[model samples]
Target: MRPLDPDDPRSVETAGRAYRVLARIGSGGMGVVYLGRSAGGRAVAIKMVHPEFAADPEFRDRFAREAGLARTVGGGFTAAVIDADPEAEIPWLVTEYLPSVSVRDAVHSSGPLAADAVWDLAAGIAEALVSIHGEGVVHRDLNPANVLLTADGPRVIDFGIARAIEASSVSRPGARAGAAGFMSPEQAAGDAVGTAGDVFSFGSTLVFAATGREPFGEGPWHVRMRRVQSEAPDLDGVEGDLRALIESCMERDPERRPTAAELAERLTGRAGASAEGAGAAGEGGMASLPPAVTAEIARRRTAAENPPVPRPRLEPPAPLAPLPSSPQPWPAGPGRYAPHSTMDPAQARRPRTPLIAAAAFVALLITIGIPGGLWFTVRDTGGGVEAAPSAGPTPTASAAPASPSPTGIRGELTFTIEGSGRVSSLTYMFNGKTTKLTKVRLPWEKTLQIPSWPPRIPWKLSYTCPPGGSSDSVAVDGNVIIRGQGSSGTNMRSEGVL
Candidate 1:
């Protein structure tokens, strides 16, 4: 068994019942997910919300309502909710554990799925959505991360952002819900959404599985949002029946898009058939996945059954015999150590050699106007004095100006927002131009590389949250700084020099 992380909770309880947390498996903007075991020995995935959000009444209410809806969903293509405590000091929900990799990871590691495999994936996800929507819950965030590819099929998980059909807002005002590339146009626009939104997201996910790229081309969050809203998806490499089905689901008009039930029927060749017939047809879909997928699933199961043994680490070789202590005298020079023969044995034994060397080093630094606290080696090159390079603070005048390298910014720009209020947008002004970041989630911290530009460029950052709450703006002066304030009047700041 793998050792537990230091930060993993030893145990957690709800309603006075305890669960031994084994390890952390995942984390997101809202909470951390832990692998845990109940007293009954059943394993579960426990999602614990950040403590800061637990105090927000709105968040608690939403959490409770969603967890209740999630309990109503039942199917082979989805993980079942086991327990939840939305009122707990740290709100948490537990679901049956499914040991599987996400479709995202699968595609990243093994490339895009074959046409048959993509069809199987679509059918499984559509069935999951049918069950989820049948329970009157809309999974607002149905992206790749929320879909788990198991031996049985792809099991839809993570209904944390789900809400009832009648609920007006999935998130606070001005804050859009769902992931950027997977969101439907309506979702990106912050408009009322329903089961259709999930269909659009499902279509996008299929495109990703088939082509290993988001339907919308990559860029900043806002750019992806624009493409989702206005531009046709770049389905260049996708073709055949799979292409037609994905295109139907991705129709711009929500009314024109196929429902999850309809999608399952069409993909399984049971279109215009009765519900029972469609169910029977869909049952055979998983058996049709590409041989590669089946092989991968079997390989994974076998590996799980028998974990690899860790190899023992070889001990490092013993340090070479201490070089024979040679009685070498310091080279004679004006600013160098004198010959040992010139010093008495008593003086050398007095431990004054370091003191004398230090004094001479200090004098040399003063003479050369070198910065203090810097270590330098002075050498006589037979004719002139030479100094070894010093690993210290750069000199003000001679130092090269820090700038974004050809590859990109030398470092990353991080934004961390705390408290109950959500961030609606983040704007960065650089070189007389402004880029607005609208895809950020509330109570989220993200680090992204800045676009390449000249060194010492002046920049500014501004963000918007709930109105009437005090928020701060920070100026970017070629140095890293974390600046933001919470809705509850909590101040936050951090700095890192590149």
Candidate 2:
């Protein structure tokens, strides 16, 4: 969470209802989150749209539409949206306050989780996507930061929150909307992102949880995106079933990735309307998490349940002049007090700025050396994204065009290495350049676009591995013209230089 601005409003009122903010929870480029209580005294997280965004007509419409769409999301894995006031001068929405540690922080403080824990985490989040997508909302940016760890299971928060930010022209027009390292290739290219993009992010989050590193080695945002666009994920230590599943989720070809439902089913070992089975298994998912993560969860819960008490702010009283031994009860005349003139009606008619008073009060608390005074701080999910589209100015975050063949290449040059015992070493010579990889995951693939004009160019390939067989093929117009089928432990060397 970013530092709080002491001058921010202490409470927000809308629709004849008011919620008092204790302190700023956090701030983002688009809004400020505050730990507050509703009129009924229920604690909630109030996400207030930044004043600049609230002032934009287009943005208000988008906020209303997006907030309303967000209200439809339900299920245990997601934080519930309690209330919202989009029409208010300063729009705000309320979400259930989650008193738990974030997955990213837990991972950073501890280490990569065990495979069983990763599976539980994946299944729970996948089921969350099932609920979110069912309402026609895409989380757009699904990364570790947005997932909270609790005793029951991981709860995915800030669902569909990014769509509001993405809609504002303020959100860097034409720039890729998601955070670095977790963006899908299409999303990174500023192309329309969809449910498949979320699936890609889910895979990236798994990689983070399993390997404690971005699938695409990180540097600058562009550098990470470039890796996402062309390179296979670095699943160095991650192996076996989870590796294959995560690999599938991050497939460069979005269509080839599994749907949220399929992922839930796969990870939870459920079948026949597995989405339901997935939700059942997700109930006690946190049981698999490492002890460090569990301890963090307990700490957050305890801290939230029992807030720190502030030291009393006391000041020395001013000394008064020696009091008269006997007070005089005289001077009851007109001259004793001067009379005042009537004030202007306009001045009297002016409305009081209660918010200013509230701000001043909050500022006093902070300035007077009260730590976190009544305010509770919580972190926002960044290096991540959430939320989907809705009414007004229609959000710009979208998935790649439905069809890949039209905008994509017609002739596809494909290569694969299946039946894995872990590729200790694998290399490829592509477009005249050669590269090799170590500890490679199985069922690896690389596809190149063959332009229609140059359909007959470079339809040739050859490769050799220690024992595991590697396969390469060239196809034009969806028909396999040349093929090299290599079984396990067999060297495959074939060429079709047509």
Candidate 3:
């Protein structure tokens, strides 16, 4: 498992209960999602509202009441809502946690999905929309990032931004309310967006799945928003029946587009998740995907279920005579450096004090500034984009237990939040431990440190900053680095393996 990022919460309370924040999952314009577990060990995804949004009187009032309506949306393709507290100081909702990949990340990593896979994706999303719309909820933000691909099918998440039909129709003033390229023409014109807007956005998402490019073509979001307002989508790669269905959904006039139910039946020969023949073209619960993507998803599932816990840092072995000109590789698991077990037979039997000290020295060197060595490496992915989580073995629940004591050294760990030229107080936590800092200044972070090489028990963190344009990120043990910038506002997150 990865350590939580700075400003990440270690645990949160709701419904008169506390949920341990396992790790921060992803951050969006509306809120941040964290991998959490109930006291009884039930895994859930706890979504906490962004400070700025929670402070908005209009949005908060709507979120406090209508957000609960999301609970009414139940289907095979949507994550089940467990609990929610819209009335809380910072509204939060909880859902069953599922290890899955977003359509955006998948396409970016593996290229455009196969044609058959794209159709399956469509049927699943359409079915989910049927469930959502049936409950009178309009998913105003149906971008590719909100659709998660699971073993069963594609599941649409993050309805926290959606409002009930009986509620407000127009989006919050000055806010886009949806992804720029995917928003409908009415939405671009700042008009009331109904369920048809969701249909339009669905079409754009499909276009992206079929071709690894934006639906309205590439440029700044404003340029794309303008294209969405008046220009035809560059559907160069989409073909045949799929193309027809996409074009129908993307029609400029909302009245011209098929309702989600109609779309679902047309694609899957079924109108809802419970109906028979739910998947398209004889595929079962899942759409047929490329073997590579399928394998990666399975690997991710295994890893999530059997996450690795931090252990007491291992000490360097006592040094002995060094003479071997060449060394053979030793088998090990995932990490910055492999298990260093190979040693001269004579040296292996010697006392270990000196070796431990030497190893510590090397590990410290690597942690502070050196690129690579025997242990940890300080990874700062400063380019605003975070690298994908490194793939590794899926450790089991009954795997190695943590050492009883901590033998590692603590070093200064700094945290900084880039805001709209205003200092914002923040909160951060780890391993179910927490602290709140108020009126703190930004720039270089305060002191934090690490001593031992590979920590066994991983720490989790959370950050809550008042809205506006700001960036929040943390590099823990150099394993995970997350940054949220640009249109996503002050909230940022990225996932990486420990």
Give a tens-digit lDDT track for model 1, residues 8-75.
46677877777777755545445567677788887777888655456567778878888888898987
In terms of TM-score, the best-performing candidate is 1
Prediction RMSDs, each to the true structure: 12.2, 24.1, 16.8
lDDT of each: 0.62, 0.63, 0.63
Cα lDDT tens digits for candidate 2, 187-249 = 766688899999999999989998898788855344566687888889899888888888899
Ranking by lDDT: 2, 3, 1
What digit string (tens of lDDT, one per residue) describes model 3 on residues 149-203? 7766788986645542113222222334556677889877768888999999999
**Residue 19 in candidate 2, Cα distance off native in Å:** 2.5
Deviation in angstroms for 257 in model 2?
A: 1.1
Looking at candidate 1, the ten consecutive residues that score lowest on lDDT are 473-482
